[model samples]
Target: ATGNYLDDLSAESHVILTNAKAEVEILKAQVGDYLQFIRNGYFCLDSKSWEQGNRVYNRTVTLRDSWAKMKQKMGL
Candidate 1:
């Protein structure tokens, strides 16, 4: 009876450990997915910021050219 009880306890412990390990793996996968999502968002935002900077630079250049043309025409 003692040996049988010990065997049952060991089997139960093994089952619990297996379940815990599977749960940990699932949580790890979820974390990985979230991290990748954050990385993608960061890249998207960075690209948008760069595009905006380019737009501002182009506008500034256009404004400067127009100003130069106006001054030349006005004999300044």
Candidate 2:
């Protein structure tokens, strides 16, 4: 989804991710806290949903695919 406010009004661009094996410490994350989801990217906890007792994270930046770069270097 896009991070642009005008492009994603209604928060409809949000995607719900399921992590059944996530660490317990994730539950302690506060609103506005930036978190890195391993191979995924950086995301911030949504404040509005946090106030409503929901865990909605908005992706901020995506992780660069180093593997893709390696593939390109190998001309594959």
Candidate 3:
């Protein structure tokens, strides 16, 4: 879950996440490739979409949380 990722991040983790946008792109491609070889009849594939949505959601929450904390600290 996106909340889990946010809660799991530490200062060191945030440093690595500076390039999370790029890393998520790589992850998405890998996911797609994994899906390609599967022709299972019951694979709704909605889970794949959900994973991508989580990545974007994480990206947004990460930045937005940073901004909110900064604004609060600045009394803005």
How many clashes in each structure? 0, 0, 0
Q: Write down the RMSD of all candidates, one decimal each.
A: 30.0, 4.5, 15.1
| Per-model TM values vs. the true structure | 0.18, 0.72, 0.21
Give the runs in model 1 whose Cα sits over 4 Å from its true position: 1-64
Each candidate's lDDT (Cα)? 0.31, 0.84, 0.39
- TM-score, prediction 2: 0.72
lDDT of 1 by residue, 1-76 (tens): 4667765563433221122122343333321132122211211123343446521101111112577799999999
Higher-lDDT candidate of 1 and 3: 3
Candidate 1: worst 10 consecutive residues by lDDT? Answer: 54-63
Residue 15, candidate 1: alpha-carbon lDDT: 20
lDDT of 2 by residue, 1-76 (tens): 5877687666645566676467889899998789998888898898998999898888889899999999999999
Sort all candidates by lDDT, best to worst.
Answer: 2, 3, 1
The digit string of per-residue lDDT tens for model 3 on 1-76 reads 3678777676553322344223343454432233221121111124555667743221211213577799999999
Question: What's the TM for model 3?
Answer: 0.21
Cα misplacement distance, residue 3 of candidate 3 (Å): 20
Clashing residue pairs found in predicted model 1: none
Best by TM-score: 2
